[model samples]
Target: MTYRRAAIPALIGGLLLAALLWWAGSSADALRLPGSVGTLGPDAVAELQRWVAPWAYDPPSFLDAGVQGHGYVLLGDDGRDRYNGIYTAGLQIRYGAVFAAFVLGALLLIRRLPPVRGRTTAAFLALWAWGAAAGTLAAAVSAPWFIAAAGHGSHRFLPQLASVTAAGRQLPVAVSLVAAGATVLVARIAAEGASTPPRTEVPARAARLAATAGTAVIALSVVVLSYQPVAAALQAYSPDGGLLAEPGDLLRQWLLLGAWDAPAAGAVVDWLLHRASDVLLLAVVWWALSRLPGLLTRVTLPAMAAGAVGATVLGLLASQLLRIAVVQTGPQQGLLYSSAAIGNGIPAALTCGLLAGVVATAVLRLSLRGAPEPAA
Candidate 1:
């Protein structure tokens, strides 16, 4: 086999696998494993783990069931549905995508090789396929660990998300992820199977300028949307627009920013803005991780590892921010929802962050004309 073909994919697969293994450990409630401490009880801990636990995802039916109930139904007794809003992606959709990609990569690599009869080519493809699947599965399973460490959610699994705007609020973020993920998959696949197109790309200066402009646009839009309120009257909240005050004062009275001490409308605007901010910050975390190789040129591997740690840190910050922004900032109520939210968010954030870093390092190394070694 040509060295580039054999070595490049193996390296990328290794980096991807390492990231996945990190994610799986995170998913296992790395924060609250058997010895894990925190607000979550065994029951709550077990609740989120059911989704990402390793080898447990064998049956497609369980995933479908999880989606229908956790995905579509099941509001908690708290009158605010936490489960539906959290986890973000259903098990089958997220992990299934990973599994599919690995299987496809394996088949594509095998087919591209000079036609060899049966087992020899098959065995080689199987080894790489196994690597890809193992890594992707690890990341899927580890997703929860990063979420739990964030510490944002309630402790219960089936909490009610009875609020009206929440459904509207969550839709945009979910749509963004699905679209980005799909694009990444399709683009990478096309790049792999098709011949490398002629390298007539834009100059680095223009590309940097464009990236800067994109960041500025996203930032400005987020800020304006946060401050700007829609003129349409909001739907009457559950229990009849009880959001006339701060959330902590009364349970679920979360008038958001609109109903806050300010013009309830302004408060609502701020609340929405804050949600956008969390999403943007999560994006920042991802971008920062993607720059790991360039950022720490002398210590790329350690930098990748640090990217994982940083992701976990970012997830925790994001969780705290979400609690402050969305669900009422309060002292007295049960922390069930907060704990669960963190459990879900922290791991997922770390998962993405770590993946971004690994992928970044992989691409940088693979494309380098001649990478330098660290000094002795």
Candidate 2:
């Protein structure tokens, strides 16, 4: 099928799937696995209540029916059974729709673009520019909704999100666009070399080297950029923000913190250790993505997309596990519990990550399905 014809149907299908997943995730709280700390005992219940207080009119109550009501009961801000407002649901819809469009658009653009001859400087510049434009468009379309959501309860749950939400929103879109564009561009370049009459070892090796370097740069840059939020989160534990060490310090803590060495050190170490699970969770995603067949075909898209969703759920569980660990580990005699920080930060990260992952996965899968196979 022509790229456009295939892409349009795929986009529509993705949007539908995204909407379905969003509704199910938000309404059903599918990410809140049973036997999770939040659904366990009295202290856990209270903690869950406090966590939900900002968003819900009433804190979630554990329902032990072992059937339809066998989990935490969510009440909306209006005291309704559901947790989200009309505006909240609308926000999710917009997020899902825009994400699907951006992913599909990038895929379609990549498929439609002329094949690249080699690692031309012009090609790199053009791809970067296109990525920037796509990211800008996505931010423009989605930022208003996110900003609006920010005021509702996001700020309460994730202190300072309003300040950096725009950047956070833009970065993912930009990265996704750049990744998709570069993948296609590099694939085409490789194809060109393969199709040529004379296959020179040097040129092919150069192309492979360049591709590896570019991918590494992009991946490392993203990881570095992500560290800021992690650092900020770790800093929240300190009242005067004294534990507000450099990103390097936080990274060190994340990598090294094993046992409570000292009071101050233990606090930072514990916090970092908690947040570091996200890295492991992300690794799970990378592992799943890697397991996808090397061929860039439509058949594997659904599985990859499902893996994304599954990874998200796993990440949310990881966050909950962090919370459970904190409570179970008990308070260090000399250390103070930064309830404000933990209460505010973890829930925000969990909620946003869960929602964003669902939207991104749905869109990415649809985009992949819509994209045509690379020419042999």
Question: After superposing candidate 1, which stretches have Cα over 4 Å from the reference?
Answer: 1-43, 50-96, 99-209, 224-376
Which candidate wins on TM-score? Answer: 2
User: Lowest-scoring 10 consecutive residues by lDDT in candidate 1?
Assistant: 164-173
Q: lDDT per model, in order?
A: 0.36, 0.35
RMSD per model, one decimal:
16.1, 15.1
TM per candidate comes to 0.30, 0.32
Residue 77, model 2: Cα distance from true site in angstroms? 14
Root-mean-square deviation of Cα positions for candidate 1 versus the true structure, in angstroms = 16.1
Candidate 2 TM-score, true structure as reference: 0.32
